[model samples]
Target: MAHPSFSLSRRLRLSLVSLSLLACGAAWAQQAPSSATAPAPTPSGHMLAEIQVIPRPAGTADDRYKHVDAAIAVIQASGLRYEVHGLGTVVEGPPEKVWPLLQAVHQATLEAGAERTLSIIKVSSGAQAGGPRVEDLVRKFRN
Candidate 1:
């Protein structure tokens, strides 16, 4: 017979794992294309997205900047126009290109030894009434 505490801990772990899988499924659904063919580009032929990929290593307090820089390297090599902000990175490009690039960023962090990764993303269509541009958004309030 197992201890009650051990059984409870195991159940909690299972619940957490199930929730994580569900979250991943939801993220994939959001990024997935609606049709088999490529998506139509906006009038400006581009879109803007702000993505923050946070990787939490399981143990110890150590330097995580290396993981961040690794992910940034992947972004830099993608050839898309991007701005690295203090909190997140803003990338502008067609949806076909940007979505894969974001996936690459998350993968890079995991390959760099992140136990688990979380990506927070915001996307805006260029056809929207007031779309975002890195320059306009960043420079508007500058001195």
Candidate 2:
């Protein structure tokens, strides 16, 4: 007759080994290097958002100027980036604050004659070596 305790011990050992292997595989998968197209990190250690407004009817030179100026004013007033053409804007702060700001900007741009609004969430490169940083604009404007 086999010992019941021995059987139980064997089962427990097998379970532990199986669990460890699964855990290791998961960790390895997560640690693998991501492709360039992989998602970027947000400014708040979360996902980032990029908003772009393309003018509707493709306004004239003066119209373009006015539209951009109005949008810029709103962005400046909101204390966000006026330009996010490159690595994109970096809005770092609490989500509570950032969420509202993003929403407000979205609404405001749409109202400013934008045919469509493009919003992207990704990581900020934060300027680059020997290049301008997102903070530069703030410093330049002294805001």
Candidate 3:
């Protein structure tokens, strides 16, 4: 049951459900009944993630961009496989390195003088062994 104080309109509920299905499709979505194959064992700590850092520094658009750049610089220096997309930067590595790298990237924005910041991230890992790779998902799309 939903919280009585937090009810969503029917239309909004449907939209949220749709979005949830898309977000979880690879990991948790229901699959068609099949007997030929079984799911892989639990994932390793390897990950592929997209991180979006929004720095709200007291400054003009260019200044805000500079803060974002600061965060990207941290990403660039980490030496992880990464690609800067329009909304976020995608990074791939083992969890040990990626976790610290995420913290450093978030802190970079504040260190660059952002009053406050918001970071959004989406992380996924392969079902089998080995670290996830950005190329695994986007290589075909790239061409």
Candidate 4:
């Protein structure tokens, strides 16, 4: 996962550092304090999507983030179980709800004034009535 050529903002850098620290701490779980608690259990029969929206700025120096906010607003009102992270948002719900929500998020970003926007989404579903959830995968890395 070497990406030495890319430049990220200070906020993004700090967030990455914070996430790395949490992961490193999890790797040393044998020494974790007894008071540490695991993440809540995952809800069953849902799909998962981790999404990031990249909206083209007005110019080389523009970073107003109006478009980003627009996309998040749509997600916020989606009535699904979700968590907003530094790099992306994790959303979980039934397939019927999740798919359209993602589309609306992308469209909202573009409608917010981005000449073009890119939405990177990673989706996962399980074969059984239930599947892996946000809490299931990140429980080890979260308290």
Candidate 5:
């Protein structure tokens, strides 16, 4: 038979091991779920508007060309696309950042002689992974 002191020590060790395991489990439970571990909420995708600028009172072809070139340069710096669709340029970026930039661009263009305010056409944000992009269903499908 085990000595009483030895039995007590063994019981303490087992209790310590069990407590350690429980503590570790609690820590893991408290951690926020990551993309790889959690299910996404949205499935397809979201939309962003691309503002089209048409400088009406450009005064001359050179002024119009300059306005378009300046807009393209801003879009390029912002890491967006510049697509030609007959009338104006189409660029893409996150709405939160892009919309404000679009407004600035529109304001600048108008001050430079544009007759009308910029027109924004809805465009899909394509797809992204995790975060707000997760709200986009298309991103989920891509994954």
Candidate 6:
């Protein structure tokens, strides 16, 4: 017979593995390609993602700005539509494209001499045909 503690630990491990698999499956489902031949659909609607990258550099404040500028350069080159705000940048695209671009942005910050980095991200997905756009959301409140 197994020890009680060992049995409980085994159950916990199994539970964690199950949860991890379920999470991965759900994520894959969202970005899965419609067919084997064609690439994943850009999903007619839009998805909005906001990302803020904070880089901790060893030098002065200017060093931090340098990292941010590097990240912005990556975003500019990504070709996904984006708007830069005071605190963060908002990007609009399908999940398949936006996710990879965000990753690239983070990596660019690190390559720009940041010893450590923190990335805060927010994502909103819409089911509507055109999806939600940044302009539309702010237009209603503007004077």
| Best model per lDDT | 4
RMSD of each: 11.6, 21.8, 8.6, 6.3, 26.4, 13.8
Q: Cα RMSD for candidate 1?
A: 11.6
- In order of TM-score, best first, we have 4, 3, 6, 1, 5, 2
Q: Residue 100's C-alpha lDDT in candidate 6?
A: 91
Tens digits of per-residue lDDT, candidate 3, 48-125, equal 777877666423565636787888999999988888765578777787888899999989989988889778777777
Q: Say which candidate scores most in TM-score.
A: 4
Report the alpha-carbon TM-score of model 1 versus the true structure.
0.61
Q: Which stretches of candidate 2 lie over 4 Å from their true place?
A: 1-49, 57-61, 80-88, 123-143
Compute the lDDT of residue 71 as modeled in candidate 4: 83
Model 4 bad stretches (over 4 Å): 1-44, 58-63
Residue pairs clashing, model 2: 41-123, 48-121, 48-122, 50-120
**All candidates' lDDT scores?**
0.63, 0.42, 0.65, 0.69, 0.47, 0.66
Q: lDDT order of candidates, best first?
A: 4, 6, 3, 1, 5, 2
Per-model TM-score versus the true fold: 0.61, 0.39, 0.64, 0.67, 0.43, 0.63
Q: Which candidate, 1 or 3, has the higher TM-score?
A: 3
* lDDT head-to-head 2 vs 4, winner: 4
The local lDDT score (0 to 100) that residue 134 gets in candidate 2 is 34
In Å, residue 51's CA in model 2 sits off its true spot by 2.8
Q: Write one digit per residue (lDDT tens) for candidate 4, span 15-50.
A: 321132243235544344334664444556678887
Q: Write the per-residue lDDT of candidate 6 for residues 1-143, one digit (tens) a residue.
A: 76675567544432221122222234444543335444334457568788777766522465537787888889899888888775678888878899898899888888988888777777777666545456544433347
TM-score of 6: 0.63
lDDT of 2 by residue, 42-131 (tens): 343322234443333223456633443454455567654434442233454444555776667556656777666444443233242222
Clashing pairs in 1: none
lDDT, residue 6, model 3: 42
In candidate 3, residue 143 scores what lDDT? 42
Instruction: Please give, for residues 62-101, the per-residue lDDT of candidate 5 as tens digits.
Output: 5535554555556667765444434444544455666766
Provide the clash count, candidate 6: 0
